[model samples]
Target: MPSRLRARDRVQGPCLGAPAYGSAVTTPRLVVEEELLRRNIDRVAVGARVAGVALRPHVKTHKCLEIARLQVAAGATGVTVATVGEAEVFVHAGFDDVLVAYPLWLDDDRATRLARLAGRARNAIGVDCTESAARARAMLPDVELMVEIDSGHHRTGCAPGDVGEVAAAGGVRGAFTFPGHSYSPDGGSGAAADEARALAEAGKALVAAGVEAPVLSGGSTPSLAHTDTGVVTELRPGVYVLGDAQQWELGSCSPDDIALTCHATVVSLAGGRVVVDAGSKVLGADRAAYSTGFGRLLDHPDARIVMLSEHHAVIEMAERPPLGTTLRLVPNHVCNAVNLADELWVGDQRWSVAARGRNG
Candidate 1:
């Protein structure tokens, strides 16, 4: 069996009764448990530190400066972002080291902005093909580059054997992979192994092309526990900070570790179903092939989100808890859910989704 994250203490699950805010807070709001959030961050940070590996968490999951600051304070070397706009946000907030982990097709405006951000901090962008690599080198030579290798996700990244040419063309400082396949049911261990092998081969190819692969970056929330720290000089796992329904289903994180949840109210009980105000708009419609539902109720594991409309989520359950009941829901994918919200609530404290719509 593959190694797993350390077990966590179980809570009473998501808050069932009226939360501290009572009816003052609106329904379908994103709420986080600060203690659980810190616990999650500290656990991963300590693990990476003990293993002598650099922890550069991907900030794309949370997108809030406060949460990113927490990660940095917990000993993260830096952060990884999916877009240059996210990089711009963090770098401006004094995150000195940022990596735009996505392979960006830079136009004049994007190149100029990225170049400016690089001047303010240690920044790198991903590249897979020679054309984009050469373009990055020519357009923003001052910025560092990382060659993306297709470990298993096959979403974006060059083949392991093709890393050398791309690395050479971009003058890349290292190589990285996503291993997104780990999100599949029971795919963690295999995906982790693939990540290690792919990065290793990519590094060798880099050496063959007379390039020094100083940094080998890879990791995702699912494959993180099984990952070989020795294979990756830097680890970049995002969603770990805020456990979601997908993580819960994969057993990557326990229900007690879920820090963020959607505080939804039972709005309708008309059709012999439990319907809440949060739907695809708030929870996102990213149900994976292996996923069982649109989202999961933290307090009620047996109940599943059967249908999700724009402003309503239909919950199929044997017992309907009267209308106006407040429940905590775990979004299928926290990253997408966070992007849809303007702010996150932690008691009376509110955190702006600063990089919420920085998709560009």
Candidate 2:
């Protein structure tokens, strides 16, 4: 078992000093300790640098400009975004390089926005199908494109063998894969190796067809430790900056590496269960088959969140925590949990989620 630090030591770190917690500030707010977040960012940056892979930290996890700037300052080559709105927001915030990692079918309005974004910085779009490529080309003919490969994610991207055809049809710049299957505990490293091989094969296929496959990318938090860059030039791992319950269960990060925590106030206790203010609305109801609960209580590991409604999370504790006591929780999925919050507090500093409600 990994060594666990005491709660006091964990809080005393530069991210959340003892003084920050002692302040008579409001409770029940989402907080991302600056020190811890910087530590996490530096950890991944060092790992990727040692591995000789370009670190394109995905911004979809936090969606905060301050965090994005911090990552860039810490040696990240660029930022990867999940949506056009996110790309635009980052680009407007002075991020020169952005990758829309998701396959986008551009409508007229979206096309205009994407063109504007591509004009601002070095931009790339993921293309999984010919239709998406055609739409993107019609909008921004000179835009760089990455052919998304289905390296076991089965979510998006074309098959590796079909990457050549997609690239040809899209007139893309290179090929990339998400390897999201790396999140599966039973098949994380194996999936990463397999994805690397598939990407290599895809690159060969593109080269044979007279297309220069320059950027071969594949990444996920679970696969970072086992990522093989022989065939890949860049990596896109987001949640590493805010280790969550999912990554913890996958052995991707230690508990101490988690940077973001949702502080909730205990409201009621009865029938051997204690209810907190955070629920699906706060921590998000994203319990994977391998996870223990909606979120984990940092100070009380034995406490299990039994149920989560829209606004209440019923935590079963051996000893009831006093009502009005503040409890810090590490959410199961940091990305979704961040999407639920309007803003995030980073130590004494705070930043609003200027792009929060943008589903587009």
Please, what are the lDDT tens digits per residue for candidate 1 over residues 3-105?
Answer: 2221221211234643544333458899999999999999999999998889999998999999999999999999999998998899999999998998888
The numbered model that scores best in lDDT is 1
Instruction: Please give the CA lDDT of all the candidate structures.
Output: 0.88, 0.81
Could you give candidate 2's per-residue lDDT for residues 45-156 as a string of tens digits?
9988888889999888988898888888889999999898998888998999999898888788888898777767999988888778876787788878888888887888
Compared with the true structure, model 1 gives a TM-score of: 0.94
Each prediction's TM-score versus the true structure: 0.94, 0.91
For all predictions, the C-alpha RMSD in Å is 8.2, 6.6
lDDT of 2: 0.81
Worst 10 residues of 2 by lDDT: 11-20
Model 1 ranges off by over 4 Å: 1-23
| lDDT score, candidate 1, position 329 | 89
Error of 1 at 160 (Å): 1.1
Candidate 2 regions off by >4 Å?
1-20
